[model samples]
Target: MDTLNSGSGKLVGLSFEMGPIRPPSEGGSYSLLIRVTRNCPWNQCTFCYGRPYDHEKFQMRSVDEVKADIDTAGLLCDEIKNVSWELGYNGDINTQVGTALIRRMPQLGNSHSFINVFNWLHSGARTAFLQDADTPIIPTPRLVEIIRYLREKFPSLERVTSYARAKTIFKKKEEDLKDLSCAGLTRLHIGLETGDDELLWKVKKGVTAEEHIVAGRKVMEAGMELSEYIMPGLGGRAMSRQHAENTARVLNAINPDFIRSRPFTPLPGTPLFDVYMNNELELLSPHECLEEMKILIAGLDVTSRICFDHFRNPSYLNAPGQLVHLLKQDYDGYKLPEEKGSLLEFIEKGLRIGEEKFLKTESYQL
Candidate 1:
């Protein structure tokens, strides 16, 4: 069974193991996920649920193990390419339409369901995401090799992204970052959860605001698309102002390609949730979150596309629409920098509408 069967099972004998998930944008864009690392190196962010803090050890898979995964995925992609060509399904081969093709192809009904993902992949995915919390910690040379090998296998892929802790990226030498960017690692997603040092300390976010800027600038200098995540309610009520203002200032400093606002919602497993329960940390009401967001937007000066979003998007192919549409980013369909006056006015109006108002714009954060 190591060889692929056109309509039945995988061609390879080694079963692939999927690690933690990714941002919804990846799914919407039909980006395939390849887990290059296991769990996060630092999982102490108060709002996080990554492994080191909860379960699992921080470990890096050997290059050979990763290559095996790529090898298996490559065979699957190759099979899909051939079958798609044979079937005359010539549409741009991303996952969504590819799945549709599989469902329509009655001949494959007898095959295992898992095999369909590879078949779906055949629609030719040009984008992929290296996952589980962060992968930049993968030694730069090995990381470069992995990226190069992946590109060789999936020649059609135009970009590959992986989450990188701001500290991890900051630790890399300038030349390594530049060379890695050139080696096919197209984008870096850094969880710059809060750019305010005070709040950063409170949340145990390891890196400071200056470090965030340092890492981000290096990514841009290396010509890699950087998506920096900012959590709106992370400061809660006590430090809300600093959270918004400093975050904007930092964004201005780094000017990442995409500033994705992941609205703060303290989940049960995280330390922040315990703080919320004890009333030690005041959670931001939706209205308060809106107010903080307003401050952040007003202070932002970068040309980066601001995505008022998190992972839980509503419909397929639909980005959890922004507070207002602005400039668009090519990687994951982001909107940024709407007119300040009109945007604030719109937000104020939404605040007036209140929690009773069920809107995607207000509840975009999860």
Candidate 2:
């Protein structure tokens, strides 16, 4: 490991590879991020068009490379704990220890790796997220080795999760999925996007609705929690009803542990943005999006938590002129069947607030 001499003491040169993004829930929990792969394996999907990875080619890091990163992160954690001890915090990582360590090693302030590790340690280091789009796309044995190695390095990790493609999960054998679960992969966040076959084909999602159900059920059977992402307004106005109804139908069949809503916004530079510019597809208005959500929620028969955890989910202005979100926006979200009535009432409240109080989809463009 590299080292830097600071005025107070020696500091390990903490540098490790990290991916562009993880699920918002992972961010909320301050999960330690490990980049097992680089970029996305499948960069299609007109909606995203792989913009997050800058359309870079996907590449798998050798097991040694990933292990080295994990080791570096572990070293950083040890160094931080040492600093805490020297600061009289008795090895407790906290705001004071973090601030003092950064003051002693100013370079840490600019290190994303240090920031991620520090925040994760401060947050209890109970979880981790494997990064880049589809981690399970790696060979089963190698992926298992990585997960086990991660757990071995950080025994405090209680949950490990990753973003996976449904088609990839469907391609895996049941025994392989069980191996992954046994290796400590606790959850998978999949982009079900929409279950309408027409919309799925139009968006080049590369997976069918049946494939989603099969993959979801397989994960559940493997004893791994599954979170399916649904994109409201993905079908636009033309297929809104079908999109909502079919997506709920698919989720109902799978009964995933969590159903996350990611309201669609046509980001510039994506193929869908060009389609929107050409007026080939119409975006849903705020009220229409809420109505579509109402249809989707009413159709859900699952026992999952439905979350609107993303900022892109619909919001409105209250009488006090302050911005307000329609849904709770928590990671756990609202429980279905029990809180279903209350969630529907929230949608109704948003609908009654009228379209004028809400921002247009175009306003969300980046």
Candidate 3:
């Protein structure tokens, strides 16, 4: 009776809808996403475009709503398995056919939405991400229940993660965080954009540098892997050096499990973009940004792994000549303290290339 086809009255329709965003790491994980909250409660970060948070009012879903999402995701797994069997798939659906099957879903209509489910199953759904930015800000008890219920329904799921605002994570008691971790909240992606208080205020990040350090350390202490996203040129031309140095200082304090390098890409819609347009915020050219990134990498004294995986970051070594195009990663990712010198060398080389690429990029932003 746990099956979708078993008259559960839970999602009579086979189709499923997930929130608009997930961490870049989760994109390839085929992770089941349960949107516990509506939009961001604090969507004021100027560098952020947490869509549809940009246009929608924020709201929290009830416990029942969250549970229903888990149930639906569970049923989806069941239906996908059923469809695979019907198609004579002996526990393995080829990627090519799985892709083609997805393409033909509309022709099959809602009645045959199992094709959609089959696509997921073929890809090996092994993880889950609680979506719609910053779920850790949700009440501790409610979040605990949601995590527990999600694990119960998808017990074999490998890991569960969610974005946590430093302000929210800092406010939660240490004991509550440990409880949440025990309840299966394994990872957290925090946007510690910069360690400069002035930049934090300018971006409206809602947390100071000290709180960011505290919240990040708290996550690690509670047995959660922390991925701190650091923007290289968030301070723009004015505070670029301070941004890099202060960010390095903060990362050294937390020594987070992962330091994600997110080079600044001014969105045309945000206040920062307006600041750039009005010449109030002197934007960092590709060379300056790379130099800033070099300073950041050279200054980092953490044992954390660094990932220059975002497309916005220039991949000096790997991509060869995409320095200004906003199109390549230097490498997959690197474990810091070891690859530190090499990462800096790569960035330094790119800085020497001295090309203004971002200005030439024709709208990579959607």
lDDT of 1 by residue, 186-228 (tens): 9888889788999999889999999999999999999999999
lDDT (CA) per prediction: 0.71, 0.92, 0.74
Clashing pairs in 2: none
Best by TM-score: 2
Which structure is stronger by TM-score: 1 or 3? Answer: 3
For model 3 the TM-score comes to: 0.87
Worst 10 residues of 3 by lDDT: 1-10
Model with the higher lDDT, candidate 2 or 3: 2
Model 3: pairs clashing at backbone N, Cα or C within 3 Å: 315-330, 324-357
What digit string (tens of lDDT, one per residue) describes model 3 on residues 1-366?
Answer: 111232222223555456677777776565666789878888788877554466577778888888886776667666455544545565465654344344444443353334434444556666788877878777889999999998887667678999888999999999999999999999999999999888898888889999999999999999999999988777888999999889989999999998887777678677777777787877677778777877888888989888877776664333354334233343237887998777777766666653743332124354
- Model 2: per-residue lDDT, tens digit, 201-234? 9999999999999999999999999999999999
Candidate ranking (lDDT, best to worst)? 2, 3, 1
Candidate 1 residue 151 C-alpha distance from true site, Å: 0.6
* RMSD to native, candidate 3: 4.4
Counting clashing residue pairs in each candidate, in order, gives: 4, 0, 2
**What lDDT is reached at residue 148 by model 2?**
97
